[model samples]
Target: MLGRLAVDVAIYRDRVQVTERKSGIFIDQRADHPFSSDTQLVADATRFEHALSHALRQILKTGAYMLYEPRAVVGPTDPALTPPERALVRRVLQDTGFRRIEFEDE
Candidate 1:
């Protein structure tokens, strides 16, 4: 492989973005509406996971097959997270096939 690809993920209550560090390649998606919190930021587990998984899939689609599982540096979410929220966040990352997950300090 030419090099490793890592990414930064920012998941807000209403949106989520996954950006490849070197190329600035990214996928940013909003919830169904301005007032909707479809990403749910770890609240609605199913929707949150689906939203994140979709974004991560876009990243994978970019490289086709050469990219390794990315290490995602997930920053603090917009609405803040509780202990359970953190665990759910990890679960989403793991389910999405990220090689590693480093949650930013709050």
Candidate 2:
């Protein structure tokens, strides 16, 4: 792969035992610890290359917290996503049926 892809996700078993596309990476530091998702790059792999450096930075910065926080809620306090990153996020969330909740910076 020419680019780097990362995600932060939660893992859940289904009724049917099937291999699924893993959207996250896991760090098994302890038995109590659970597998975590890679939430850094929520975009498709092809596009992830565009933000590889940023995504890697995010992963390195937040890797330790992945198990505790699998999902990220982007608030105004959250640094704004770059134009391309925002577009990618919007596209992915829309595809997954997540309502785009845009809020103005108060």
Candidate 3:
């Protein structure tokens, strides 16, 4: 079976926005603990990448055996992503043969 999976991700200074297409579910996740005072950019980027990966994995688990046409939605003014973070996202999309990323206004 073939399925369509669309993920909308928006990165913000304090949080990450994720939307699952099939279920129309929206999740706003903090990149780090609210009380943490860490200022390391790398840490922040890692957290974002981990959060994003986890969300994507959860969604993919739903249709493990099906072929998926993945799509990503992001905003141009989205939060600053480190090189590794950007590469990770691109790699994930490429691994899934994702279609063109859709840009949207915040």
Candidate 4:
């Protein structure tokens, strides 16, 4: 995801001749977090949330306040995310101060 975001940033930086002052963030949450068979399922939620927060921070360097437009976060619905995990993700995005956030399962 970071790699893709890097490529996008490069493309945007090159194509943008003027300061648009508006940008959008679209996150594709298709990657799965690996866990050992012995690991408890309960721990997975926290780990995933932490990793997600770290990744988002890395992608949005200056922080969410820098984003001038709404952000959309999408993920697959096959595996499905537990309610708690989804709530955690929403909280993280909100805490980052995103002007608008939309989460959809595709």
Q: Using lDDT as the measure, which candidate wins?
A: 1
Model 2 CA deviation exceeding 4 Å by range: 1-73, 77-79, 103-106
The per-model lDDT (C-alpha) reads: 0.72, 0.32, 0.58, 0.37
For candidate 1, write residues 1-106 as lDDT tens digits. Answer: 3546688988776677888887788899665433224544556666777777677678767774444776889888767776888888788777777778898874
Q: What lDDT is reached at residue 54 by model 1?
A: 73
Name model 1 segments beyond 4 Å from true: 1-3, 32-40, 64-69
Model 4 regions more than 4 Å off: 1-46, 61-65
Worst 10 residues of 3 by lDDT: 34-43
Clashing pairs in 3: none
Q: Global lDDT for candidate 1?
A: 0.72
TM-score of 2: 0.28
For candidate 2, the lDDT comes to 0.32
Better of 1 and 4 by lDDT: 1
The estimated TM-scores of all candidates read: 0.77, 0.28, 0.54, 0.41
Instruction: Compose the digit string of candidate 2's lDDT tens values, residues 1-106.
Output: 1112223322121100111114344332221222212433232433332233233344445434333212222333233344654566445434433343242342
Write one digit per residue (lDDT tens) for candidate 4, span 1-106: 1212211211010011111123444333222453212322223444444444544554456334434543534333333545664565456546654445444552
lDDT of 3 by residue, 1-106 (tens): 5457777877655465677767776776665443112442234434556666666666666664333556888755334545565565566556545665655642
Could you tell which candidate, 3 or 4, scores higher by TM-score? 3
Cα RMSD, each candidate: 3.4, 15.8, 4.9, 10.7
